[model samples]
Target: MDVRLLEKEGFAGLFMRLRAEGLADKPLLAALEQTPRTLFVSAAHADAAYQDRLLPIDCGGFAESADLVARLLSLLSLEPGQRFLDVGTGSGFLAAVAARMVERVVTVDRYKTLVQLAQQRFAHLGIGNVIARQADGLKGMSGEGAFDRIIATCAFDSMPRAFVEQLASGGVMLAPILAEDGRARMARLTKIGSRFEREDLFEVPYRPFIPGLAAAL
Candidate 1:
């Protein structure tokens, strides 16, 4: 990948677009500048790498929605050296970007083939701080609620109870929350004591949350 191309052209355009959309952020723009989105998926879609469009990947999944991905990452408000849990970790595109800013990323997907392919991509990229696993997204990652951040690429009819339970206090859960009318709304929820404060960020269209996944949320 031509790393300079992102800084020289891709990110420049991304910044302008984000600013016009009222979505600009320094950290996310930096991430967009540093991470080569083309490296995350098949060569067939390479031409569309920085076009701000979602592309198809394995397991009938679409790489994180382009604008949504950027905005979602920004909303997570990730800091350097933090740990992030990525549920529905698709092509590892978001995880790859996360690895650049965070200390480590624990990403899980329910699809075995996707996990294998994503792991291969991670290895090819020489990324060592990410653990990509094929596990039920609703089950949530175990261990002491130690993550500093958590985000799900998929959208759920309701917030997953497991995600809320596993979230560390003061940590945020970024997800697409499906409204009663079935429209997806981008949101960020912060765990506070035993309760969570959900904030709707924007409207979005996403692949539905996994089957039975909403029931548990």
Candidate 2:
């Protein structure tokens, strides 16, 4: 419908320009174009959908920053046929994008309303590969290790041991880890053998992990 706000303030156009300049993947650019951010945000803030900034959605928390999402995806260098786990599905924007590039996307969030909205969005968009569920993310998913990629949108005080155990060899996980003082930082962890190596990327701010999420772990 009305993408005027996105045209005026949303950096989608700039992202496309970057894609054209070869800074980003062409397919990702296409997915961004295909998904309407306006639909993910509340009606009051719908005009802010296209902006680079995060906008408040149905929950008390806001959506992830577009720049952060794009940057994370770029760092992951996703490949088709990979199994992906998204710790916080949020408005399902990232999962929707991943659905286009990955064979399967398993995303979870603690909030039932958020999951329901995401599911509705997925249905509306005709996305079939992504499975969105309402579950605690901190406890780690009980699935076969060997996931090609794992992403966490919520801030974690410590790297979840379960997540590390579930990562496939050479799998990469993008997460926001909190410092002892509660400051948030983004890092990329890659599993090698029985250990995982971490590379600090930059500072970030994200909502704390869901309450029961960490308790279940």
Highest-scoring model, lDDT: 2
- Screening candidate 1 with a backbone cut-off below 3 angstroms (N, C-alpha, C), the clashing residue pairs are 160-217, 161-217
Cα lDDT of model 2 by residue, 29-69, tens digit: 66766777666777787766656677776657688756567
- Give the lDDT of residue 167 in candidate 1: 73
- Which 10-residue window in model 2 sums to the lowest lDDT? 208-217
Relative to the true structure, candidate 2 reaches a TM of 0.88
C-alpha TM-score for every candidate: 0.86, 0.88
Model 1: lowest-lDDT 10 consecutive positions: 208-217
lDDT of 2 at 170: 92
